[model samples]
Target chain A: MANSIPAPRAEGLHYLGLRDDIARRIATGLLGPGDRLPAERRLQADLGIARGTIREGLFQLEAEGAIYRRDRSGWYVSPPPVVYDPTRWEGFISYVEAQGRRPATETISAELIVADPLLAGVFGRPVGAPLYRIRRRRYVDDRAVLVERIVIDAALAPDLLSHSLDQSLTDILKSVYGLSVARNQVSMRPCALTGEDAAALGVKSGLPGLHVQRLSHDAGGRVIEFDHEYWRHDAVRIDVDIRVR
Target chain B: MANSIPAPRAEGLHYLGLRDDIARRIATGLLGPGDRLPAERRLQADLGIARGTIREGLFQLEAEGAIYRRDRSGWYVSPPPVVYDPTRWEGFISYVEAQGRRPATETISAELIVADPLLAGVFGRPVGAPLYRIRRRRYVDDRAVLVERIVIDAALAPDLLSHSLDQSLTDILKSVYGLSVARNQVSMRPCALTGEDAAALGVKSGLPGLHVQRLSHDAGGRVIEFDHEYWRHDAVRIDVDIRVR
Candidate 1:
C-alpha cells in the first residue's frame, strides 16, 4: 500500500490528468458515445497510477455526466443528455430526432390486466375494470436509456394491444383512439434502479436513476394514461418554465 | 466466506424480512425521522444474520428512501420528502410549514466577486462586472438537505450583501429592491454529490443528489438571479403541471 501511494500533489495531478484526458478524447471523437473505457487494470498499468486514484477520477467524470459505469462491465462515455420539456406535448422520437440523435423503442410486453386499487382510482374505474399494461425499453443512439411501464384505460381504446407498441403511445392514442392529451401531471424524483429496470437499462442494480410519473388527461379531464418511467440518471435533463403574473 | 453463506431461500428471507421489519418499525413510530439505526455489527449479532445480508437489507431500505447512510456514520431514517412545485412562487419556509415541517437556512458565505465569463453571459454584463455571491445551506426538520449558491447582479441591488441572506432571497428582492421575479427558467438533473456540497449536507461524497439550476427574470425579462442547488435525493419530490392548449 505504501509503495502504491504517490505524493499528494502528484496523485491529484494524475487523477485530474486522467479525467481530462478521457474528456478530451470523448470531445475529439476519439472515444464515441457508448464506447467502453479501458479496464481499470489496463489503465493502472498504462498510467502508472494507483487504482484508487483512477477510480476517483472516473467517479468525478461520472458526476459530470461524461461517463457512466455498468455493473461488472467497464465504464462507457455518455451521450449528450436530451433536454426534455414537460410543458410540451412532444413524443420521445420527435425530441430525440430534434436533438440530432436516433431514437428507438422495443416493446417488452403488452397485455390486458385487471386494474388494481391504485390503478382503478387513477382511471376512475372499478377494481375489476380492464387496463392495457405495456412495458417498453427506449433507446437513444442505440443505448437503452429508459424503461417505461404504461397503464391505459382499455375501455377508451379497444384493441389497443393490437397496435404496434414500439411507437409513441401519445401518437398512437391521438391517431387511432381519437384521444389527445390536454394536460399532464408530472412528478419526478431521484431514485435507485432495481431489478427489472436495472436489467433493462443494462446497468447494475442500485444505480442512481430518475423516476418520472406522468398522468395524462384528455380535454374532457378524463384520465387516459398513466406512465412510470425510469431513466438513466445521465440520459436526460428536465426543464420547466414558470410565469407568475 | 463459506461460513457466511446461508441457504438461498433463507438468505432472501433474512434480507427481505429485515427490510420489512425496519419499515414496519418506522411506520409504527418505533423509529422516527433522523433517528440513527443500530450499527451493522450490532444488527448482525442481534438478528443472527450474516453481515452481508444485513447490508443488503439496509441498501434496499435506502433505495426506498426509508433510510439513508451518513458516510462513516451509521444509517438514519429519512424524513418524508417535501413536495416541491417549481411552478409555484412559494418560499421555502411557507411550503415547508404547510407540510408540517420546520425550515431553516444558514448563510454559509456571502461576498462580492468579479463575474467570470459564464456569469457575465448569464447576466448580460461584461466579464469584470461585480456580482454578489451567496451560499446557503437549507434545512428541513433539523437536517441539512440542500445547499444553494446564488449569484445576483450587484447593480440591481446596491446593498444586497447587507441584507440577511438566511431568509428567503425572493422575499428580500421583492420587499427591498421592489423587483419581482416574473419568470423562472429551471433545469434539473440527477447528480452525484461532491466535495463541498456533500460536506455541507453531512453525507459521503459520491452520494446521489438532485441538481437544479434556475435563472430568474423580472417582468422586463432581465435576468436577476442565477441559482445552483444540490439537494439530497430523498429530501424532495418535484411536481410540475403542464397544460397543453
Candidate 2:
C-alpha cells in the first residue's frame, strides 16, 4: 500500500495527490466505513502537509461520497452505498437483506387521511375521499437511512390501516388486496433535507438528500400506492441497465 | 393574483404558508427562474414575520428544489429541473432540446492518455494502451450545468481525437467509428462537488451534486465509452419507468 501512494510533489496538485492516497486507503480497507479519520492536525503532522491542503483533499473525498462529516464529530468513512435497482421492485427490506445487511422499519404513524388533490389525482379518487396514510422510518443495520410516506387508496383495501404498516407495502398489496405492482413511474431529485426529514434521518437540516417519488399501478392499471422517500444521499447508489432497441 | 396567496394563519405553520405563497408565485410566473427574491430583512418586513421564519421558509423551498441560494446573493427561484431519462439513450443534446432548452457543450480538453489498470480492466485491454480522453462542460440555456470526462478505447477508432468533440459521443461513435451503443450500465449517487467540477459548474466545492457513470458497450459487446458525469443536483431530475413482467 505504501508503494501505491504517489510521491508527493508539484505544489498545485498536492491536494489531488492526497485525495488519491486517502481514496486508496478506503479502497484497501485500511479505513472502513463509519471509522473516524485521524484528526486534521494529526494528519497534517504525520504527512508533513499543511492543514489547508489536508482539508482540501478531505473536501474532495466528501464530494465523492467516500466520507461524511458530522457537525462536531469531524469525518468518518461512509458506509458502503446500498445498491438500488428500481426494476427489481422488491422494496427496501429485500434489497437491504440481499446486500447482507439487516433491515428494520418503524411505523411512525398510520392513520386515515382525507385525500388531498395530489392524492386524488394519483389514485383517481374524489377529493376528500378516505385514504390510508402510513409514515415509516427505515433502517439498514440499525442506521436510520430513509423516511417514507406512503398513501394507499382505501377503496382498494379498506382495512389496510388495521394491518401491519411496518412491512413492505408491495407485499401487503399483493396478499391483502390481490394487486401486484405492474409498473412504476419513479422520479428522483437531489435536495436539501427539510426540517421534518432531517429530524427523521438524524442529520442536520439542509443536508443534501435524494428525494424519490414512486407512483405504482396494478395490473388493471389502477394506481395502488404513491410513495415519497427521502434518503440520506451518502448511503445509496441507484443502478439501472438500459438496453437500446 | 393576490387571491392565490393563502391567508396567513396558524401558529406553527407560518413558514409553510410562506413557502406555499412563494411557490405559487413561481407557478404563476410572477417570479421566474433565476429571479432573486427580496432580501431577508425585506421579506421579514413584507411578510410581517421574523427573520428566522423567513429563513425557514426559504430553506423549505430550497429543500423542495424550488429555489436555490448563492453565497452572498439572496434566494432565487430555481429553474424547473431538467428531466433525464437514461433509457432513452438520446444523448444530452436531444434530451435538453426536447425539454425546450438550448443545449451547448464546450470541449475543455481532448488528448490521448495511456490507460491505467482501471481503464484497461474496463476496456479489456492491457495497461498503457492508448486511449482518447475528452473532457467537456455542458450547458442548458447558457447555464453551465455538467462536466463530463469520457475515455474512449482508441484502438477501436484510431482517428477519434481528430474530430470535433462538442457533440454527443454516442453520435460520434455511430457516425465516425461505425459503432453504436447497444447497452449501458449506469449508476448514480449523491455526492458533493469536487474542486474541478465545482469550478466548471460554478458551485461551491463540497455542495451536493449527482455523480453518474456509464459504461457503454458496442454491438460487438466491446466497451466503447467510459463516461463520468457530475451534474448540479438542483438542475436535473432523473426519471425511469419500469414495466414488471
Candidate 3:
C-alpha cells in the first residue's frame, strides 16, 4: 500500500506564495469584502498550481481572518473586523459606523419570562421574578456578525416589549426607562458555536466563536441587565487599553 | 447505495445526558482536572449507548471546556480556566498561583535578531535595529497552555538575555531594569493554532486558539515590549470592568 500511494507533492512554498498573493490583493482593495475568489479549478489553471495547494492557501487565509468559506459555496473576502472596547459605553452602531461600516440590528424574539436560577443569580432577583428576554442579531456591512441575548428587569420598563426592539438597549434603557448604565462587567472566551448561534451568524456549527457575557449596573450599582453575545470568530476583535497606575 | 446505509440511531438525547452527567461530575470534583476519563469501551458498556453517541457527548464537553482529549489518548477533565485582567499589573505566575494552580515557564529560544518591518513598526525602531527576541511556553498545573513571543529594544535592557528567561519578564524589567509597566494596549481574537504553536502546546494543529497581541509601555510612555501570545482556547478567560461615570 505504501508503494502504491503517490508521493506527496512539494507544494509548501507554492501554497505560501499563493496565500501572500491573495493577501496582497485583499490589502490593496482589489478583492473587496464579500467578493468571491476564483473557483478552485480556475485558481489551479490560472496559477498553474495543484487544487490541493490552492485549498491549503485558502485555509491559511481563512485562519488569518482574511477570507472565509461558505458552506457549499466558494471563498469570499472577509470584511475588516470591528474593534470592541469594553470600557467604552458606545453602542455597536456608533463604533461600527465610526469605523466606516454600516451596522444594523434585527430583533428575533422578545418576551417576558420568569427568571431562571442562573439569571436570578446574575441579576440578583428572585428565581420566579419576571424578566424580559430579547434576542437580536447584529450586522456589520450587511453581514451578520453576532447574536445577542439580553435579559432585563421587566418591571423597570413595563412597556418595553411594545417598542421597537431593534434599537440599542442601552439607549432604550436611558432615554425611555430613565435607567442609566453606570457600570459594566464583562467576561469573554472562545468556544465552538452552537447550532442556533451558528445559524444566526450564517456559519457552520462547531466553528470557533467568541462568547461575551456582560452585566450592566445602574447608578446605585444594582444589576439591571445581563447579556450573552456570540460573535463570529473573525467578525470582531476585543481591544482593551489599561492604565496600570 | 442509499438504502445500504444503516438508519441513524436516536442518540441526540443520550449524548446530551452524557454531557450533563460528566459536567456535573467535574463541577462536583468527582472528576478532577487531568484525570483521564473511563475508556470508550467502558463508557459504552456502562451507559449502554452507541460509541457514536459517547463520542458526540465527549465533543460537546470539549467545546464547553469541560474535558479534552490528548492525541491517541483518552479524554481528560480540563482545569477551570484562569481569569486574565489586562488592567491589572499581575504576572502569570502570581495570577495562576492565586487561582490555586501551579505555573511554570520554559524558555524555548532567546536571541538577538534584526527587527523586521513588522517589528520595526510596532517598536518604533529603524529597520534592521537589533532587538532581543524571546519565545517561552507557559504552563498551568503542568499543562502547557500558552506560548509567548516577546520583542524588546536591546538598547534599553542591556545584557537582559544573560539572566534567566523562564521567569516573568515584567518582574525582571521592574526589578533589574528599573522599568515599570504603566500602560498596555491589548487586542485579542480567535484563531486557528498554527503548526508551531500547536506543537508547543502539545495539541493538534488547526485547533481553535486565542491570539493576543500586546504593546507594553513604561512610565515614560515609551513602548518597551511587544508580545504575541497564543493561548489554548480552553485555558483562559478575559475579564474587563468599566465604570461608565
Off by over 4 Å in 2: A1-31, A36-77, B1-31, B36-77
TM-score of 2: 0.79
Can you give the DockQ of every candidate in the order shown?
A: 0.58, 0.47, 0.54
Q: What is the interface RMSD of each candidate, in Å?
A: 2.2, 2.7, 2.4
lDDT by residue (B19-78, candidate 1, tens digit) is 878878999999998899999999888778889789878877776677998778889999
The sequence of per-residue lDDT tens digits that candidate 1 reaches over residues A182-228 is 99999998887777799888886666789999999999999998999
Q: Specify the poorest-scoring 10-residue window by lDDT in model 3 chain B.
A: B1-10
Please tell me which model should have the higher DockQ, number 1 or number 2.
1
Tens digit of per-residue lDDT, candidate 2, span B69-143: 776767877777799987776899998998899999999999999999999999999999999999999998877
Model 3 residue B57 lDDT score: 75
Tens digit of per-residue lDDT, candidate 3, span B79-111: 889898877777899999998889999999999
List residue ranges in candidate 1 displaced over 4 A.
A2-32, A43-64, A70-72, B1-32, B44-64
Per-residue alpha-carbon lDDT of candidate 2 for residues A11-89, written as tens digits (9 for 90 to 100): 4466777887888999999999889999888887777777877887886786577887776778889888789988677
TM-score of each: 0.88, 0.79, 0.82
- Best-fitting candidate, measured by TM-score? 1
Candidate with best lDDT = 1
Which lDDT tens digits does candidate 3 get at residues A57-154?
78677766778878878899988789998878778989999999999999999989998898888778899999999999999988888999999988
DockQ of 2: 0.47
With a 3 Å backbone cut-off (N, CA, C), the pairs that clash in candidate 1 are none
